[model samples]
Target chain A: MLYIALKMLMADRAKYTGLLLGIAFTAFLVTFAAAYFSGFMTRGFALIAENGAADVWVMDAAVESVEQTINMPDSALDRIRGVEGVRYAVPLALGTVDARFPNGRFQTFQVIGVDDATLAGAPVLKDGGVPTVLRAPDAAIIDDGGTSGKLLTPVLKTDQWPHDGAHLEAAIRELAVGDELLANDQRIKVVGRSETLPRFPPRPLIYTTFANAARILPQERHLLTFVLATAEPGLSPNDLAQRIHARTGLRARASEDFKTDTVRWYLVNSEDVGDMAAMLILAMSVGFGVTGVLLYIFTYENLKQYAVLNAMGATPRVLLSMIFAQTGICALTGTGLGLGACVLVGEITAKAGYPFRMMWFTPLLGTVGVLIVSLTAAAISARPVLKLQPAVVFAGR
Target chain B: MSTDANHEIAVRCQGVTKTYGTGVAQVAALRGIDLDVRQGELLMLVGPSGCGKTTLISIIAAILDKDGGQCKVLGHDLEQMSQNDRVRFRGKSIGFVFQVFNLLPSLTALENVAIPLLLNGVPRGRAEERVRSALDSVGLGERMNAYPAQLSGGQQQRVAIARALVHNPKLIVCDEPTSNLDHKTGQDMMDILRGVAQSPDRALIIVTHDPRILGFADRIAYMDDGRITDIIAGKHRGQLQ
Candidate 1:
């Protein structure tokens, strides 16, 4: 009987194909949306991820996330270092500075300042150079993320501009170790390129010594954005953070807790989250909507066959089982194809620098969602079949 | 199948009554139908349109419930059986052939013929073996793999008949079995149905309006306005004409 049910469903080629594609499309869209969301959330805490050596981050009491920071006075760092369980503390500064590229084009770059002596929180350079390379005079390390886009510099010198009314067609290339830029009218050399995790709303990144950053940027009264600290051996980071918060009277979070806080802040404040949610809801509506209508039509068209079977002594339970079998087959096949397509697309997009991550839960959620759609379709298709009177087979006579 | 010297009653209906719809739209389809079908007999219920022939057969097949009456098919009281019990009983004891052939268009003739046996919990391999023999009996063995749309009207009706007989149920009910076929094809269908009724433990009930196939029945019950009008032997076809 189940075999017959399958045959009946597959006999109508158009409806069968429509149903498969509808479910597969739904699965694909749902999974892609979820993976994109996961990728964005990961990027939301990317800075915290790159600064892996920091056990705890102490900030102003009103600062909630790393992205939105309130600079503490220089004295805050001293107070944090003086707290119990704090092995040592370093000042980390974050601010934006407009840099003039070689082509005379200006772009704003996110500048991160690490401690001058220990060079804590510096990203690993791509060329295998140590962080001590930043110790060079007026030196900065440009992150690889911005090298190909915003920081791309023309090979031609500024004086070599084609002034004869001819197209210059400047041969531009990524900024590298020997390139130079101007920030606040001060000359800075790019010492190396570091491979840091990409950031949300991707921006060019510049890393320099703390003292060099103060000299290159405009003067300010409160220059310290955060105090990065490490815990002593055998002492937990959470305990150190608690001690720092108590003594400094500021917000202190373990590294992992800070990452969570940053992600939570984005979830609450970012419009991008709402856009992703709307896309997910739209996918579900379209996927379930098309599949449900097609399935209902298929069942309605076969009502005569069901009546015949019913008259031939098929119980309601048997008939219901047949509908479920049909729905289950569609769900499994469609979801498998959808998830496979998602992984393939995710691979391509990730290479193209798109925010897409396929976590283990992404496919699981897709399968579960498709199963729900299939079950709803089955329930709706089963109603007319269950209520069908076998006598209907004799009606037209 | 051997004949029994003492004839056994296959279906007995007493004061069976049924109604359809409600309020101003209420209509009576069966008014106290009292009829009996004997084992090894082919009984045809002949009636005009809107008469109770279909309603009576539906009740006997256990597909429809009667508003009032005592009805027993194959010695079991239908009113006494629970819904599940009735379904199981119908699956085990009754078979049906419908007008327009009602064969599932997607299934091959052999698979369609195997439905009743499958419904009775017969394993597929065992059921297919019996289905082959049943199709062979209907002279449709060569067309077993053909879908209904691929076969002629006569062939499709033969497949429906084979389906009706595949499980070897005690009672077989057919509604308008020959109405959709031409003269020669209709006669052929009647011949296949007559052969199935020869089994001594089984009885056949056919609800039809076609008078051309009147000679094939052992008895014909005439119905008018939801009431049984007359019962005449099939040999007295001249009287009906």
Candidate 2:
């Protein structure tokens, strides 16, 4: 009888295809929205993700997220290093500077300054250069995102000279080990290129030493952006963070907790979440509207056949099973197709540097949503079937 | 077509009454009806349109409830059984043929014939074997794989009959089985139905208005205005009324 039910559903190819498309569209929209949100959240904390060696990050009490930092005083690092469970603490400076490329193009680059001796927060370089490369005069490492993107310079020296008005099209090349840029009228050299995770809002990165950053940036009373610390062997990062906060009256968080805080801050402040939620709601509405109405029509049209089955000894339970079986098939197949499509699109968008990630939970969420749509459709359609009078089969007589 | 005194009664109805709708729209369809159907017999109920033949048969088949009546089918009182029990009893003991044939268009003749057996919890392989034999008995063995639309009107009717008999139910009820056919096809259908009634433990009740198939009945009951006006033996068919 379940086999027969499938046959009956497939007999009307138009309606069957309509139902599948409706469910598939819903799954696709829901999954795409979730994946987009996940991608944005991952990128929101990309800096913390790349600096994996740090167990805790200490900042001013007013700081909320890594992106919105309030620079701490230089004495904060010494205060944190003096705590009982702290192994060591290093100073980290974060600031944005106007960098003039060899092609006479100017762009704002995010500058990260690590400790001069340890270079604890330095990103891994593509050529495996030692961190001692930053010790050279006016040396810096350009991140891969910058070399391939905003830092592209003309290959010809003639094109490197500044023009008066509009920019000219020329053959260009990525910044290499010897490429030079000017920061605040000071000449800086790119000693290496590092591969780091792409950031939200997609700013290019420049890594240099703490002493070099002080020279490149304007003098200020508080230039230390954060204090990176490691915990002792026996102490957990959370416990160390709590101790640092208690002793210094500064904001301190475990590395993982800081990442989560960064993501939560963006979710609360940005409009992206509301937009994604609206898209999800619209997808669910379309799913319910189209699938529900079509299923109801399909059942209503076949009421006579159901009546014959009823008269032939099919109990109401049997009839309900057949209906659910039909809807379940639609739900499973539609969810598979939709999830497959989302993964394919994710691969493409990831290559193009768009924020799109298909996490495991995203697909699971889509499957649950599609199942609800199918169950609602089955319930709405089964009402008329259960209420049909078998004697109606003999009505024309 | 004859019934012996020892043959068990398949259906017993007394003072069966049924009404449709309520309030100002109320209309009585069956009023104070008494009838008995015995095994090894073919009974025909003839009547005008809206004369309650369908209503009474619906009550006897346990698909509809009677307003006030004592209706017993296959030795079980239908009014006293729970809905699930009544449905199970009807599935195991009764078969039905509708006026429109009511064949699911998507299924092949073989699958259509296997429905009753499947509903009775028969395994697929065994049900297919029984369905093949049933279709063969109805002279549709060659066209068992054809869909309903692919078969002609007479062929579809034969498939419906095979479906009715596939589960080997003790009682078969048909409503206007031959009215949609030509005279030759109608007579052929009657011949097939008469052959089915030859079993000593099986009974058939047909409600129809066609006069050409009257000779196939063992007894005919004439109904009009929601009541049975007269009944006569098949040998005295000319004395209807």
DockQ of each: 0.65, 0.67
Itemize residue pairs with steric clashes in candidate 2: none
The list of candidate 1 runs beyond 4 A from truth reads A73-89, A100-105, A125-131, A144-148, A152-156, A159-180, A184-186, A216-219, A231-250, A395-397, B1-8, B236-241
Local accuracy of candidate 2 as per-residue lDDT tens digits, A87-179: 989999988888888767787888899999998788778888776799898999988442346778778777775565424477788888888
Q: Please report the TM-score between candidate 1 and the true structure.
A: 0.88
Model 1 chain A scores worst on lDDT over the 10 consecutive residues at A159-168
Highest DockQ model number: 2
- Number of clashing residue pairs, candidate 2: 0
* C-alpha lDDT score of every prediction, in listed order: 0.85, 0.84
**Model 1: how far is B223 from its true place, Å?**
2.0
- Give the per-residue lDDT digits (tens) of candidate 1, residues B1-241: 1122246889889888999999999999988888888887788899999898888999999989999988889999998998778888888888888888889988999999999999999999999999999999999889999999999998998898888888888999999999989999999888778765457678888988899998888788999988888887786333222
Question: What class would a CAPRI assessor give candidate 1's docking?
Answer: medium
**Where does candidate 2 chain A have its weakest 10-residue lDDT segment?**
A159-168
List, residue by residue over A124-145, the lDDT tens digit for candidate 1: 7998888898999999998844
Q: lDDT score of model 2?
A: 0.84
